[model samples]
Target: MKNFFKIIIIAAFGVMLYPLFDSFSGNGQLNDLASFYAQKENVEKVNSANLVTAVVVTYRGLDTLGEVTILFLTAAIIAFFLTKQSEVRTLRRNSEIFQTAARLLIPVIIMVGVYIFINGHLSPGGGFQGGAVIASAVILMLLAFPNMPFNSKLFGLIESTSGLVFVGIAFLGVLIGTGFLDNAILPLGTFGELLSAGTIPIIYSFVGLKVGAELSNIISGLQSVQADN
Candidate 1:
């Protein structure tokens, strides 16, 4: 009887959502607007090597900021769930071969991650993607070596500082422009150059730092929970 009601409710909700989904179209004004933005004149401004990244970080910066906030919130929720456990479980100590391999590979992984982040304004990868990669590498280390304890305080500090810095940078943009996130004040450099994307690269780096710290903290918190349980 309970299962029957749940199925009915889900079906009703799906019926309610169908119209909204059907009404959404990839045609008309939205298509025209997108095409306008994709023109060569605009594309050549931010080096145009990574046109999509420019679109995301500069053309739609506010949306990107909101996305970063969502990631941060997700990390917070994961931390909340994991931090409640009292006895954290430790990884067994017998993976010497795996640990050695991870230790050897960590530096290369970090280098690639940093390269991805630095080139984000001029390439396909961005801060968020690079940050996730770095976090995953750290997680690998955590899994390989059980003796090293993660410093939660440091993680929290980095996350908070990076988030504050991001806001501060955005505020600077506001001070120079009409709104809080306006990038009008920053100087747009020459195209195809390393430092040409105005404030987008800086903002992306800050976002990457904040995201990396938050994700690592979440994973560490989960490990603690496992140890506790």
Candidate 2:
């Protein structure tokens, strides 16, 4: 069955890639709407060097919020179904190398994830990417220390607080700025710098924290259920 699925996926991928065989023709230029976004006026409004950050956090921030909500719902549903274990279970230990690696690398991995989100307004990454990276660090830790004490409530609190702060910032934009999720609720800091893009970095930071904690909650919930089984 797995082989059949793989074959089907390979064939579908091949069909999708067939279009690439055709000659790529057309002048390299931004489309009308994209060109409008690149205009000095619009760029200055968001004041983010990363165009994707401008679009996601400011222009279509409501959509970003919705996406984050969906993830929260998903984690909630998973936690609801996965009953927590009342007693700790002894699990097999990992190899020495994995244990050492987890100890040494978890902090560095987490720092990298934080960096990705913190500088999201100036670079190619954002909250989601950073959050996923953080989740991966948690995954590695879980694998290394299977019997480690997991703190689901703390993670939940962080997730909830971050989400609330994110919403509060959005409402501030509505009350003070021209529209919902406007980046201008605060001063648009100097461009091409760490503190630029007004509330963008703040929003993205909270988003990363929420997403990371939510994902960790789901993972720990799954682990608990597995222990029960």
Candidate 3:
């Protein structure tokens, strides 16, 4: 029967994914690269409290650039998918308590998200982590106030402008620093200060803003579609 074949197919696919489950083993090419970046020479020059962040934002900045590009491309693809459909009903709720709670929490969440992005050079959190946190805050607002419409155009503009600004900063680094994406142009500042790492924090802040906006937009769109359905 068709049901039997479907079950078999799903079981096969699940078996295929089983190999992906593995315990952590740290020895690898990436570990070697990390060790190199953590060396005293690079760490002192970058003046970052978190060596991994320094490597990602400075030494391997081009890779970071590519990663950002991929995210932008993904957002574009998602937008394209949404554009094909019309008549989506935006999600809304009718709970006063939820609305009040969201309003109270939004500011606090935004502050924490900004702090995470700003302190990335000295901590475990970074632009992506902070961005997700902010996006969740936006989602909270959506859940609380279903009737309140979001300005999708404004969010899109902010996301696009922030991305372009990040590109411009990297281009400027080429002219002032060693090369394209080189971050030696700005003063590194103190090792553990918020303003340290030259322009890393600034760049991460932009990334966080862009990512948060885009992700919030995606959630908005998806919820709209779900409501329509």
Candidate 4:
């Protein structure tokens, strides 16, 4: 009877999802809204080579700010709760090869993360992605050195400073440009160049740092809770 009910539920769920696929034309043409976003006229307005980034950091910039704020609150809450527990937690030993490999990869991973955010306006990746990549490195570090002290003060300062610069630049857009977070506040420079997207690269760099710091803090807090025994 349970098997019979499961089949019925699956059929019903598939039926609901099937209709959603029709919305995608799959003909490789941009929809009207997408066309507007990447339209040639916009190249002058925001010279970012990556249209998605133009939309994310310029058109819908406020949403990104809110997302960062939410992440900050979440990390703060988790850290608060975890601090009550003893910070001394023992981790099982990792193989020498494993430790060596992790140590070698951590710097490479961090560099890739930096590249992703810095090239955000010209390529597919952005601050959030780069930040997550950086956080992954911290995870590896925690596993490699279980007893490594978590630098709450340092990360807090980095996170706070990065967040402030992000907001400050946005407000600068309002004062100098037509709207908030407008990339046009500074010269949009030649399209496709590294320095082409006005303040976008700078903005994304700060965002990447802030996100990386917040995620690292969360991981440090979590590693404190688990014990080897």
Candidate 5:
């Protein structure tokens, strides 16, 4: 009976979504606006080779800011719940081999994460992916050394500071450019270079740091809850 109901629900959703399926059909040609944006001259305006990054960090920056806000709120809620637990509990110990591997690998993982976000404007990887990688490294530390002191305070500081920096740059954009979150606030240097793309690298760097710190805090909070259990 449960399986019957599940199938019915799935079929209903499929039927409802069927009309939108035609939206995916492409005629193998760019529309007028799409063609304009796809031109090399237009792309060079943002000073980024990666069009997706250009869209996310420049064209739709406010949307990205909203996403970061959601993550920060979620981490705060998780931390609040974890702290409300009545008892302090320690996690079990792992093998020395695992601990040593984690200690050695954590820095390397963090460096990779930093590199990904720093070069986001020039490359494929960006703030969110890099931040997830950093969070994974924190998860590794928690699993390898369960009793290791995770600094929630430090994470909070980093998160807040980065968020502030991001917002400050956005405001600067308003003051200098066409409107809020404008990428033209800073010089769009030589295209395809590491220092190019105006405020893109700077914005993405803050976003990466803020996201990584928030995710690390959430992981630590969950680990604490698991320890208590």
Candidate 6:
């Protein structure tokens, strides 16, 4: 009976997606709307050399915010579940060589993560990717030093402050610019420069910090559960 229901669901999903596949143009040509967005004049409006970044941070800012919120909620839920459990499990320590390597590589990973988010508007990387990189560094630390002290309060503070700043910037756009999450809240500056792309760099910075902290908090919470067991 369960297999029957699963097959039905799969069939339904395939049926729903069929029209989208059918609508694809056979000719290898860009759609009119896509071509317009790709045009140099349209691309220059956001002052971002990366068109994908311009579309994400400027054109579809709210949608990106929704994605961030979803990630934050997932981390929060993981923390909550870990807290509810009373049993603690001990984690095995890594070898000395592994620990030493982690200690050496963590700083470099963090620096790369920061660079990725900071230059999001000018390059291909952005806050989400950078935040994941930062979180991976924290994961490595957790693995190398099982008993390493993690300050939950500090992580929470960082996450909260960064999220507040992101939202505040969005509201500021309402006050001074055309709409919420408007990149025009700050000066566009020279294209391709470090200081370019108006609020995009600032927004991505806060987002990267917030995501990194949230993920770290989740990992720490899970580690605490293991420690208690």
Give the top-scoring candidate (lDDT). Answer: 2
lDDT of 4 by residue, 1-229 (tens): 9999999999999999988886866767878888888788976678899888888888889999999999999999998898736546555788999899998999999999999999999989999999999999999998888767778789999999999999999999889888889778788789899998899999999999999999999999887777546
lDDT of 6 by residue, 1-229 (tens): 9999999999999999999999976978878977877888877767888888887877888888888889889988988788834565556667889989999999999999999999998888998889989999999988888666788889889998998899899889899999888887788899899999899999999999998998898888877776442
Q: With candidate 2 superimposed using the best TM-score fit, by how many Å does residue 5's alpha carbon deviate from the native?
A: 14
- Runs in model 2 deviating more than 4 A are 1-27, 86-88, 227-229
Candidate order by decreasing TM-score: 5, 4, 2, 6, 3, 1
How much lDDT does each candidate structure score? Answer: 0.76, 0.91, 0.82, 0.90, 0.88, 0.87
Model 2 scores a TM of: 0.87
Best by TM-score: 5
- TM match of model 6 to true structure: 0.85
Compose the digit string of candidate 1's lDDT tens values, residues 1-229.
Answer: 9999999999999999999999987655546667776777766544435767777766777788788788878887887776645554554575678878998998888777777887887877888888888898888878787558688789889888888887887788778765665544567677778787677777778777777888888888776666433
Residue lDDT tens for model 2, 38-114 = 99999998999999989898888999999999999999999899987677676777889989989999999999999
Model 4 regions lying over 4 Å from their true place: 1-7, 22-28
* C-alpha lDDT of residue 76 in model 6: 82
Ranking by lDDT: 2, 4, 5, 6, 3, 1
lDDT of 5: 0.88
What is the alpha-carbon lDDT of model 4 when measured against the actual structure?
Answer: 0.90
In candidate 4 the C-alpha lDDT for residue 201 amounts to 95
**Clashing residue pairs in candidate 3 (N, C-alpha, C atoms within 3 angstroms):** 92-146
Q: How many clashes does each candidate structure show, in the order listed?
A: 8, 0, 1, 0, 0, 4
Model 6's C-alpha root-mean-square deviation from the true structure amounts to: 2.9
> In model 6, how many backbone clashes occur?
4
